[model samples]
Target chain A: MAKSGHRTPRTALTCALSLAHGLPIGWCVLPITHFPFLLVSSAYNGCKRIHKEGKVMTFRSLYHTEVINDAGLNGHARVTLGGDFDVLTSSPLQDDPGTNPEQLLGLALATCLNATIEAEEGRRGLEHAAEVKVGVDMGKDTEGYQFFLDCQVRIPQVAEAEAQEILAKCERRCPVAKIVGSSQNVRVHLVKQFAF
Target chain B: MAKSGHRTPRTALTCALSLAHGLPIGWCVLPITHFPFLLVSSAYNGCKRIHKEGKVMTFRSLYHTEVINDAGLNGHARVTLGGDFDVLTSSPLQDDPGTNPEQLLGLALATCLNATIEAEEGRRGLEHAAEVKVGVDMGKDTEGYQFFLDCQVRIPQVAEAEAQEILAKCERRCPVAKIVGSSQNVRVHLVKQFAF
Candidate 1:
């Protein structure tokens, strides 16, 4: 693949950032990047496009979240957008009384996969009975410390093949999954019961 | 690149998982993946290879965390390993009173980068004065609903060039940064002050 083959098309990124910062789309001074996939696949408003002519663009985010961490691993992380949430972070190696990266990564994937599966269940008119568990291991590698995420999805009363299909779909559609799955360090398993 | 070029070499992954599960290295039934890089740079003991002769191995995870979610988006995510942590999960698109993928992803990066920067500060004998904030926007794209993460790093009492160097280092060293940064959809910025 050419270096240009994977440059993130800038359309949706520009649109989302502009709308989040309360700037008009046309007012964005960033260099225009024309990636057509971001142009065609976006159903945000199902409209033509974000015109650069200072016309009011219909682009907007379905959800926006902002968070800040000042204390690093031994400090607090709180929600600055969306809702009230805060977590105390500590290094697991120290046995400190707080969460750490491994925990956060696990929760991010577990919640994301289970939630996306729930949405899939809703569309199929099935009651939500799916469970997801993500296990993260932090260890030193040839390079440095790295993480490996092992995901297990369990959907009750569903046949194995169908559950696998749902898990596959969630792997594709869940945003967090899409992010982490891009790495080779992650895996998803279908299980009848969580090892925990 | 051949498809095998990117297959997750299984050395550290296997070692970590095996040690986590209390299984001996020789007893592991999984396929052996010999990624040479994982075989080399790992300073995890600066020792010899993991022999399959049922020998006692020195490999182990520095830290491990497991999390589970049963209720999906409208439920809860809690830690099952290391320390105790739990939080409500809700879809941001619904005005629900809880956390979601966006918040978790933000916290994951914010906490990871800031924590890693703190380590860097300690190494340089500087007081920890680094801060990180991540803003995530969720919108539909040609592919489907996607997330854009804008990371801002602020290092107080440091020159711009030096801080930029640190930020660039953290982008490469931080585990979460490595995972997410591999994608073109993410951007890291060094800023004088956070917009928020």
Candidate 2:
């Protein structure tokens, strides 16, 4: 038996100072790096080529989503994933195992919302506690699927008038929320093989 | 030269149904997918290789931050980016080339305050806008450099009474914000060269 021979490449950082009002502020930068491949003993008693490009590997993953309730018009809603009643799996096949689309969509939507809210909040000067509740409704057309997102946010502390102004600004500025609420078409291809 | 190939893989989809108290709920299941690979035409004779595990192909990606600035913090109150001045020759790097970190921090603090006020205003089931602002103070350390983060959040429609509770919940929920605020032991090694 031999070792797995796992290695992780690291980076060296370089720093300089930028002047601000006659004061020096620090600036940090990391340079791009390259690594050489080496050969040692292998479990198969052979030398194998190791790819050293500093890139995260792409995996072929899949996801299955089933919207229990569309919340067609009413404001309140709930959605579930997995178990029976799976809309993504019609014909049962050995190769067909559902990927976690619910989790992925949730993650993507959450990250996007986080970015949008942060950007908008940065533009305004208000510090307090904030919470966002995102609700997604999926619809279908001749093309594929469309997601309707309704986000409700709770900000604790501040005057009524100021909150309205910030809310308007956030609606216009948050990219992810805007994308979900926009008229731009998002295409989801139905494929036997899954790729991003 | 051979033409590049764009192959559309086959996608399979299925659906199932269940009744909750005689109400039918639907679910959709789809296959697992791989993360998309970048196509740098010149890299591999007009083709690109899939990034290996743990490697990131893209150099610059968006990061979410939440910053907080208490009132009466003078001088250092302003938030700016790209080194206060053009001291760092690398201008127009991304979003705001002339962004001041200090100014950004100040604005983030203000935004957090504003969100709370707004959330309070959007009473009666209306959705209010919410946001978080992040400011990082990067400086040289004995080992390398350190980044001090300040998080400010604003929820446009929160009542004053509920402010503390909401803020605490948000602190725990936001993923990127949580990682930065709680995780202080993240480490990275700097290697001059790789020999294995």
Candidate 3:
């Protein structure tokens, strides 16, 4: 990681100021051309590819969310990114047309895992249709609230053994799965319905 | 916790079968009425409250997501819960209409933290207007991809010191904050706009 050791004193100062002002430390902008000596490594290959396009690449992501009125019970969250996404804290049994944290986590996990699997298939020159279902359970124990995740990946037209191998690789490569699984427990299942 | 040690042989068998079948191990439904000897503790208060409505409660949330095409560049995900959400891997510099994982994590974190704050205020019998903004940064390091979170909370009509006190308590109680903060580094800032 050449980038890890390439932090200049000016960048350190900027980060300190940002922290003091309660701003994002990673939001500090610097012209990449000025640091021509900084070597790109395979670890940051994605970022390096983006930077090679004459663009100053910063991997930082910014997010904004506002809760409407009160919180919990009847309140809703209006999340603004490219559009407004409404999130509700209502239970799934409430017959409400709103989303929850568990749903969002499930979505993130499922999508990331599927993306990894698709990438693996592409690398292997294999084509298959795949779908993922994620189930998240939120509960409390002596250690306070915790999350249990169940992920099932169905890939038709692929051999069951091959699908299992691909899914295992995806589980190891998926970023969201790594994050959540490292922090908590996540169970992954690979199902092959029929062979084409 | 009594429930920790109350796993009956039947429940254990069911869990083993479910695991073998690639089903959710926690989805085993057992009638609570039959387990009168299992003592409820403070750790299970929240679960007990939800279960006291004379309904069998299962804290399971299921989600489905499909990858429309390949992974990474030019790829999109269709996530379906109660509603359909389209997520893209569009860069922030692009004027694209798509949501990303960072935004979703920010929404979940902001909402959960605000809910904890509201609950804390309710317990204290305090009424005040509050708003929270959560900023999450996704980047790569020597340890691979990671997240950095910055949360700023504004509470109106409350003393600065008192609001800080309450916000600190909220930080301690918020589940999402705990999950993320414990895993990574999270910076929390409590800002008081005006003196009331």
Candidate 4:
């Protein structure tokens, strides 16, 4: 174990060399002292540079789906961060009890939109309750198949103008919204309801 | 209740009028006769045309999320066709138990890929057990945040060449893959593992 008080000119030189050559450096610190080591791998350096520039943090998520039968239409999938979920297809004319891709997109958009609203409220230090409902419709047009999203947000305490402002912010800041909106000209209808 | 064997000129005229002017047609069958009425609305007319042309059937799904707290980060969401699921963000550096946008993307991709593979296999009349694992990584580049997907598909009882062919078909047909891939050049690495 390396001690923090042992960081002399030699230690600084070693750290610099490690960073320069793209190597991993490990440093051990004592209870009373703080020592920083340069585990400057190439990837680590890139991430560090990004962080130093005040960029958004990188996030990774994993998901696995095990097909239960020869028919791939049904499966069980679990996100490393989320619990297990089922995915299946159903006839448009029938009332089925399984999840489909359109539903996933709707769920994703609703949750992400709520998160964006929460983040804005947190920034403004406001305590207002809100609810979001997303309806996704799949249809075929000149561009084969496409989706339309209808998002209804109910804010009980915020005024209509302020709620509109918040929704505008979300439209610009929400990642899922940006991705889906820009892809294939998805028409998004926004309904803002003031319960108060 | 409409009766069958009532295919008179009046019934044909009614059907023609419904199809010509775009109306909602509801068909009913009686104990003694089965009568079909054309309740085809404008949208239903378009769908019927598409179906007559042998196009893919369209699917629609709805989702709702109610934010329980003033903070928008936590919420319960459910899909009309899918089961209930939770969506929440966690610190990027810590291993907290919450689902984020990235995880949802991964799950969606995995499920979509499996469904595509199943469609291809069904077309080819091949029966093989397959499982798919999708890993999505969100990183900041010069253009902001983008996603990278690594899909590992394990297929038993299929030859490598055939499996590759199936995967290629899936890559072309999977809607989620195409959407995410075309959005920002999402790098999708396909790995075929044979567990013989």
User: Largest DockQ belongs to which candidate?
Assistant: 1
Model 1 lDDT, residue B40, Cα? 25
Worst 10 residues of 3 chain B by lDDT: B1-10
Return the TM-score for each candidate structure: 0.73, 0.23, 0.56, 0.56
Tens digits of lDDT, candidate 3, A1-196: 0001111222344334225545444432335576564434111311211122232333333222222323553457655323555555544334445555555566666666676676777878887467777544554432234444556688765788888888877776665666565443355666453110
* lDDT, candidate 2, B17-77, per-residue tens: 1122222122122111332334221112211111222221211111111111111111111
lDDT of 4 by residue, B1-196 (tens): 0111101122333323234434433221122211223222122222211111112222221121121212344434554322343344432323444455555555666666776677667677877466667544444333223434445676555888877777776766676665565543243433454210
DockQ of each: 0.32, 0.02, 0.13, 0.12
Instruction: Tell me what fraction of the real C-alpha contacts between chains A and B each candidate also makes.
Output: 0.59, 0.01, 0.11, 0.16
lDDT of 3 at A132: 71
lDDT per residue as tens, model 1, A63-147: 5567899998887887776666888787766645778777777888889888889989988888999989877766565434666
lDDT, model 1, position A128: 93
What local lDDT score does residue B91 receive in model 3, on the 0 to 100 scale? 33
TM-score of 4: 0.56
Which residue segments of model 4 deviate by more than 4 Å? Answer: A1-71, A80-96, A140-147, A152-164, A193-196, B1-71, B80-98, B139-148, B152-164, B193-196
Using DockQ, rank the candidates from best to worst: 1, 3, 4, 2
In model 2, the runs with Cα more than 4 Å from the true position are A1-103, A119-125, A184-196, B1-196
Best by TM-score: 1
Which rank order by TM-score, best down to worst? 1, 4, 3, 2
Give model 1's clash tally: 4
